[model samples]
Target: MRILILGGTGEASALVRGLAGSGHAVTLSLAGRTAAPKPEAVPTRIGGFGGPEGLARYLTENGVDRLVDATHPFAARISRNAAEAAAMAGVPLLAIRRPPWERQAADAWREVGSVPEAVAALGEAPLRAFLTVGRQELAAFAAAPQ
Candidate 1:
């Protein structure tokens, strides 16, 4: 069976390595957000499939038997596109969703709607903040006085 994995995260890379020599033909797809992405064990494709329609077309044309969504949690658009495309192409789809971080007794967490909201939660005071929203969203926190 031919498998297409929508990948970018470390989990995706690990999955590709694990599937090596598994008999199934596997291909990993990256969104091309990084200038230089790490090589994968399986065949790799870069950039978007345009959207749901384009992805469906590619799945049909390439004869993909299965689809795996290993994209980042914040990549809502791509995830939706993958689901829609998988349905349209009549291909089986699987999602690798990571479990949420478990909070410890000493951990203090505040949930916010967006990056700006997260920044605003810091208040007007100049405080050191550690941003972990990913490389693409780093610029959004630049205006924060922290």
Candidate 2:
């Protein structure tokens, strides 16, 4: 079976390692955001697939038997594209989903579902915040003069 894994995180790397010598041809795909990504056990492809349609094209062209979305939890766009592309190309998709991180009593975290909500939650104070949002959503938080 030909498996194309959308990978970037440690779990994705671990998955690829676990599937080694499993009689499956696996290819890992990265977003090329990092200048130097750690090496993998299987063949690796770095870059985007344009969008859902482009991903579908790649899936069909490459004769991918299965697609595994092992991207970061924050990579919503990539996961969405993978789902749509899998449907479009008639390929099976396996998503490695991780449960939302449970906040410990000592953790100071405010979870917001949307960018606007995140901005609102930040309030108008000029305080520092450790944000884990995507690049597209970064601009929303730029309103903070801090």
Candidate 3:
């Protein structure tokens, strides 16, 4: 089976290494955020496939049979695109969704649907809130001033 993995997180790298020499053709796709990503056991393709349409085109053109989404949990856009593309191209999709962080006794973690929603959930409070979401998402919090 021809497999295409949308990867960036460590899990993806480890999974790629595990699939080494498995006989089935495999390719890992990275977003090229970093100049040098860790070497993978299988062939790696850097950069985006435009969006869902472009990704669908790539899947169809490359004869990809399976699409695995091994991206970071914060990569909501690509994950959605992967599902859309997989559906459009009629390829099977296997998303490796990481389980959400388990809540602790003192944990005050509140999950919001989107960044904007998170900011709104702050309720105009000028409080110090640790944003451990993602690096790129930090800029959106500036509006909250919390």
Note the Cα lDDT for every prediction shown.
Answer: 0.91, 0.91, 0.90
Q: Candidate 1 has which clashing residue pairs, if any?
A: none
**Predicted structure with the largest TM-score when compared to the true one:** 1
**Candidate 2: misplaced stretches above 4 Å?**
113-130, 134-146
TM-score against truth, every candidate: 0.93, 0.79, 0.81
Per-residue alpha-carbon lDDT of model 2 for 69-94, expressed as tens digits? 99988898999999999999999999
lDDT tens digits by residue: candidate 3, 12-56: 988888888999899999999878888888999999999999999
lDDT (C-alpha) at residue 111 in model 3 = 83
Estimate candidate 2's alpha-carbon lDDT, on a 0 to 1 scale: 0.91
Candidate 2: worst-modelled 10 consecutive residues by lDDT: 128-137
Candidate 1: residue 125 lDDT (0-100): 88
Alpha carbon lDDT of residue 16, candidate 1? 94
Off by over 4 Å in 3: 110-130, 139-146
Candidate 1 residue-wise lDDT, 26-137, digit = tens: 9999999989999778889999999999999999999999999999988999999999999999999999999978879986788798888997898888977766587778
Off-target runs (Cα >4 Å) in candidate 1 are none
Clashes of each: 0, 0, 0
